[model samples]
Target chain A: MRKDDTPNQDRRHALECMLWGGSGLLWTVAGGVPRSSLLGTPEAHAQSAQGGFSFVHISDTHLGFNMAPNPDPTVTLQESLERAKSFRPAMMLHTGDVTHLSRPGEFDRAAQIINATGIETHYAPGEHDVVEDDGKDFFQRFPQGARTGGFYSFDQAGVHFICLNNVTNLQAGKMGMIGAQQLHFLEQDLSARSASTPIVVFAHIPLWVVHEPWGWGTEDSAQLLRLLARFGSVTVLNGHIHQTMQKVEGHVAFHTGMSTAFPQPAPGSRPSAGPIRDLPPGELRKLLGVNRVTRVQNQAALAVVSSPLEG
Target chain B: MQSRRFLLASAPALLAAIPMAQAQQPATVTIDDHDYAPRELRVAPGTKVVWNNKDDTPHNVVSTDNPRAFRSRILDTDEVFEFTFASPGTYSYYCSLHPHMQGRIVVG
Candidate 1:
């Protein structure tokens, strides 16, 4: 095949896989960007007096990571934290992989840095964090349950937030799995909620299939989505690929948050999935940005704005 | 002045206690070139085993059992993973991504 046609072919194949996978029809992309048909028409900003709840979504801090892929991740994290604080988010949702390794020192340093922000932080475990010791160190620091890993659910601002663990049983080249136990819990967790209630699902890996070949997506996510489909408005947030990508299926919006540490090569940029280094310092910030989610009420629409940290 | 004289007289005993503490330091086993530098490490019980990623690519050091099982996530160069061995036994580990990378830790 011609070199130019490679990306096109890959995109075509990805769409085909999504169709066969049976989640929903692939949303059309205008200019290599997936259109959010599922996202309801953008409504006017609700009256400021109505008071909307907004939260900061940051991922892949990779605190201990120090390399050419943007050396000194701490600076980027500090910048992101400062930006997050400026918005005065009600809370912060860290999608996971907080540290480069599950080292106590790394966790301690990360905890110290994040605690300095004074924002209530919710966490989930990334594949990187649980790979070592099956998440013992992670749970030790950010324990959520008797499971000894970071997986739990909470409610805030009239929305149910379910943090699922997909990185536990990872296999090479395979997407993340939430496992049968968690699946059962999810079924029971939402059993009492009314269908109209807004639901927010957070995970480390993309719950929707992005690219299974490079492990960019999750395996067996359809089962989880099937459970979520019952809700009228569901927003799924994830961070693993270190880049921002979004997909929307009926009543479900799947958004991947960018990493605060470094950016990864686009789906077909390199021969395989790895850190995409060599960007000018200014450009790196643009590639790695933050997404803010705000909700007003049942009738009002949720506004998601992506802002780059670069000045 | 008399208390100061007593402290000076006990300085040798205090110095003697310092070596005992130094002798209890954990023995570190470095993972380099797809192999543990020492191959087998022996240390006192409760000694912490640190696996430093000196390789360019990502590598994992995974244990073989349940409670004792541990795996270092993908580590870039200069990243370090430390686990303290609380029990006296032989702990075996291998790189889940790169099976060729393997080593053993013997804690007494």
Candidate 2:
């Protein structure tokens, strides 16, 4: 769909062209094919919750970041969590990049806000979060996957949830890597699960290659996907790109969420991948938000609704 | 009287220190928009190189060559990290956070 959009050298106009393009897409995967609708229509807003469960996914809070596009990321993150709470999700998944610079105080600030939501939140580390002590700080603060180097899994509502860490030990000039250790863990973990069970895998970087130049994809994600091939329904959620992108292949669906901190240029829309500063006043929040995923009981379908902090 | 004579004698040494300090001033590489300015820098052995992050995002410098010569802590905007290239060799480095932002230092 974006192929029709022309690339503009003007950064602001380019951002406008790309940022507004994907904002209101309501994504759903039924029968292993993805579909979308404009948000706010009855078909999009309406949801059936009878005998079903839902969860929230938010990413890239970047708590300590203080700059244009957003001077106080903490405020936006708090707002996102409050919005997430309203969904009454059984749990929340943070795809990674909880802090901007991986400082202790930044983690403290992020914790205070996320915990305030009172929802169990699972985390995967982004490259930014593991900059300190090789992710010892991140693991110590969020110990759900600490023993296994920040990747773990659990069963919730008959859906198997696997949180994988792909940011550590990243090779130069390459995308995020899950490495051999985590792949072995994933293989072992999935082997015992029934193939009929729905699987939701969440991580910091997109399991599929979004763009090679910016390192938006995961290096060993193909191997990871192969392990998941036997599953009847698989939905992959990620957060590193800081924008909304979704695709479906076979029985697998991939979606990347927006950041609560700031917006980044769409793939190949800018010279380099970083925060998109100089956005018009009040436009930042529209491009920054969270994802709310709903799973129907005994159904292979998952409805993913994205809500902006504003608009 | 002895203190005054000592001060006068030390004045020449202090005067000589200024130029020596100036000679030791490090070469700079500005990190802006996720790219290092002067992506390839040439410096004499024993010269110091400093990386100044001017972009809003945080970045770090890590040697990518075999044996990994130098690494720096994450540098936020306006923060600086320095490494003295005391050996003559081709040093390749990149921002660990954004690996695409690569650079090289040729010391001879």
Candidate 3:
């Protein structure tokens, strides 16, 4: 199909561009442009793989969820983690909804499985993650984020990563909110960096409005975007809709990751947003998995590939 | 002065007119399929309203008015939250978790 005819086709073309390089394929940056090749090819052996790093982005594990879509979410989560582990990423960014109900047992089981992967994981809280005791349980388990109220930033291998919280203090008839306090922090955070920095921002809800009626977007993201406009390369990654969506504007690229738990209907396809209740048996896992992001040393844009749990 | 005296004289009768139990006919708002059923409800001033979550997904009730009239903790499936509207006014609320699921109550 010709590109840009429809959103699905656009997504298909984008997915083709961000093809699954983890299947023994080689991805290299030539003259700052990213290109993929077969593993046994001469160019694959000739390119330098150093100075570039990759990370796995997984979201909405929903460990305690047991429903029609998938009676056993934990098994799929495990399988997704296995797929992420295959990438052998420098780190893993769990965009949130780590547990279905944010229960203690759910948190415990999720941690045990994710920790087994042994990759450093950065997290932001989804609304589901903050429901119990206003997120006391989630913060206690993921203490690294607690200090800054689940929003923090760090640098890894020359790439700056910012984790943000947009799910707290949600209001009626409104979408996700990144309150003024957090927005202020983001402004100060960006002011210190030069425009050339390749910034990777991860959050639970999509920073851009995917669908306002379903509460899939963040309310104050315009301000966040203004702060990021100066940056030469900005990648905003999120997962709340339980599907992959991509949009590019100026220097920033926006992408949402797929859930490891269940799939939600595409925006406007269904009346409301929730887990898609019925999928013919064995069809569930095809829509469930993780996304991998890679940044070559000097390339301004990061390459993101969505990997399904099953082949 | 005459209006004040009339209101004072009628206050006791008005208090006695409404049987306490009858004033509190309970109303219900069911959360299912990610939508609030009976999105608009009408009831007496003192009616007690209960919101029950029937979907597996978690939900909450919060008044849309600034200085919210009432709010509920996140409710899991089969869980319920109740509030009594004692004054005459229109109250609008939505699930704070799923903000699009909105409902309204006209109490008079």
Top DockQ prediction, candidate number:
2
Candidate numbers sorted by lDDT from highest down: 2, 3, 1
In candidate 3, residue A292 scores what lDDT? 69
Give the distance in Å from residue A192's predicted Cα in candidate 1 to where it truly belongs. Answer: 0.5
Residue-by-residue lDDT tens digits, candidate 3, B2-86? 2223234446666566455454457898998898888999887667789888987888888888888988887878989988787
Candidate topping lDDT? 2
TM-scores of all candidate predictions against the true structure: 0.68, 0.88, 0.83
Over 4 Å off, model 2? A1-24, B1-23
Give interface RMSD (Å), model 1: 5.9
Candidate 1 vs candidate 2, lDDT winner: 2
Docking class of 2: medium
Against the reference, the lDDT scores of all candidates come to 0.68, 0.80, 0.77
Q: Each predicted complex: what DockQ? A: 0.08, 0.53, 0.48
Q: For model 3, how does the per-residue alpha-carbon lDDT over A218-297 read when each residue is reduced to its tens digit?
A: 88888888898876667788999998887766557788888998999999897778789878878887899887676654
Deviation in angstroms for B58 in model 3?
Answer: 1.7
Ranking by DockQ: 2, 3, 1
- lDDT of each residue in A56-121, candidate 1, tens digit only: 888999877777667888898988888888767788889998888677788888888998999998
> What fnat does each of the candidate structures reach?
0.06, 0.57, 0.64
